[model samples]
Target: MIAERTEQADLLAGLRPDQWDAPTLCEGWRVREVVAHLTMPFRASLGRTMLDLAKARGDFNRMADTTARHDALQLSAADLLACMRQNIDHRWKPPGGGTHGALAHQVIHGLDVTVGLGLDRRVPPERVALVLTGMKPRNIKFFGTELDGLQLQATDVNWTHGTGTPVRGSAQDLLLFVCGRRLPPGRLSGTESP
Candidate 1:
């Protein structure tokens, strides 16, 4: 998880200023908003997070969106990068989500920024495999991706999920798809690509 966070910080550090405003795979979030959301755990206290959640009427997604947008507007790209770099070793994890969830959060959001900017960054295969192995039904449901009759096959890795119309791509692309993200053209192929 530390390594993943460090890599993300490095990536952000190298981005051109204009790229900071680039759209990301995370819907409605530009690069700035995604970075703000990623660093929220490092900056927000548990009490403040709970207060924000209450303000959003207990909707986690609403709280996240509101916080990210506000933070993005308030913090510059350099500030967000500094926050990420300073907290690379932080062990914060989502409540009830453990270390694996922490890794997944970094990897997925990193992809959101990279893939959105059209950067060709490949997450390490082992890390992708670990996230794939740890996926649960609730995770899929949370993303609202309906895969009842669809199979996900990673052409670049020996991973397959479900059993029906095959959706083939790299493991990272498949991960994005499973997380309710739509990939750019040519990133995915098969009967039921997202």
Candidate 2:
């Protein structure tokens, strides 16, 4: 987790100022909002998080979106970067989600910033494999992607999941797919590429 966070910090450090406003695979979020969302766990207390959750009427997605947007407006790009740097060793996992969840959070969100910016960053294969291994049905349901009849095959790594028509890509791209993210054209190839 620390390694992932540190690597992301390094990646963010090299971004051009305008890149911070670039749209990500996260739909409505830009680079700033994604970084703010990534660093949120480090700064928000459990009670505060619960309050925000309540404010969003128990919708985790809404709360997350609200907080990310709010924090993005409140903090500068440099401040978000510093928050990530300072919490590289912090062990805050999503509720009911253990260490793997934390790692997935970092890897996916990191990709949100990198891939969204059209940067050619490859997540370490082992890390991608680990995350793939940890994927659960609930995670997919939460993302709301319909993968019932589609197979996910990673061309760059020895990982494959699901069944039916194959959707092929590098493991990281597959990860993004499973998380309900659509990649730019050519990132994925298959009958059911999204």
Candidate 3:
């Protein structure tokens, strides 16, 4: 986990100021906004998250928009990177629970930035596995709406689980799907493809 954080920090370390304004794959989000959203996963308390969740109607976009607004106010790219460096080593979690919470935040949002930027950086296999394995429970319990009933199959790995029509693609593609990137529909195949 520490290594994953470090790797992400390294990834964010090199961005120039102009890069922050670049568009990302996350619909209308800019790269800097995504970085701000990624930088501070554990900064909020659970109560804050719950409040935000309620306001956002339990939508991830709500949570993201909450943080993005906060980031837009004061977070420069350098500040976001600094926050990652200061807090990355701390075992972090989402507002709700689990050690893997921070792991998911880092890896998934990392992809949001990297893939969104067209960086073509493949996520580390072990980190992806950590999220895939850990996220199954969370996906089922907390964010089950988006998943519906799609059996996700990763051609690049042994990931096969859940219920419904199967979607087969690269591990990264599946990762991006769950993380909410509209990766090439061509690279992905499954009943879950949306």
Candidate 4:
């Protein structure tokens, strides 16, 4: 998680000021909102999270989305990056989720910005594999991946999962695809290759 956070910080550091307002794969969230979301755990205390949850009427997703939107308006790009860099080693985890979940959070959100921006940030193969292996049906559902009749095969790694129409690509690309982001076409090939 620390390594992933560091990689994200480095990427953000090189972003042009205009890029901060760029839209991300996360609907309604710009790059700055995504960064704010990434650093949210570091800034939001347990009590505050609970309060936000109440305000969201017990919807975790709503609480998260609303907080990210609110925080983005208050935080500068540089401050967001600094918070992420400083919290690289922070052990904060989601309710009932441990270290692996923390890694998934960082990796997926990192891809949210990089992949959405068309940047070449390849998450290390090992880290990608780690998250892939840990992915469960519930996780897939949470991310809204449409895998009911689709198989995902990674060309750059010895990993394959799911069934039906094959979706083949690099592990990182496959990860992004499974997380419900459509690549700009040609990055993933289906089994029948339409």
Q: What is the C-alpha RMSD of each candidate to the true structure, in Å?
A: 1.0, 1.0, 3.3, 2.0
Which residue pairs in model 1 clash with each other? none
lDDT string for model 4 (1-194, tens) is 87888888998999999889999878788999999998999998889999999999999989999999999999999899899888888988877668888998889888889888989878998899999989888888887766778888998888999888778888988888778776767888883322
The per-prediction tally of clashing pairs is 0, 0, 2, 0
Model 2 shows how many backbone clashes? 0
Q: Which stretches of candidate 4 lie over 4 Å from their true place?
A: 191-194
**Ranking by TM-score, best first?**
1, 2, 4, 3
lDDT of 2 by residue, 131-183 (tens): 99898988878888888888889998899998898888899999998888878
Q: Where in model 2 is the C-alpha error above 4 Å?
A: none
Please, what are the lDDT tens digits per residue for candidate 1 over residues 1-194?
A: 98898888888999999999989999899999999999999999999999999999999999999999999999999999999999999989888779888888999999999999999889998899889889888878889988888889998788999999888889999999899888888888875445
- State which candidate, 1 or 4, has the greater TM-score: 1
lDDT of 3 by residue, 75-147 (tens): 7777777887887678766557477777776777777777767786788676687778777565545533377
TM-scores of all predicted structures: 0.97, 0.97, 0.78, 0.95
lDDT comparing candidate 2 with the true structure: 0.91
lDDT leaderboard ranking: 2, 1, 4, 3
In terms of lDDT, the poorest run of 10 residues in model 1 is 185-194
Candidate 3 RMSD to the correct structure: 3.3
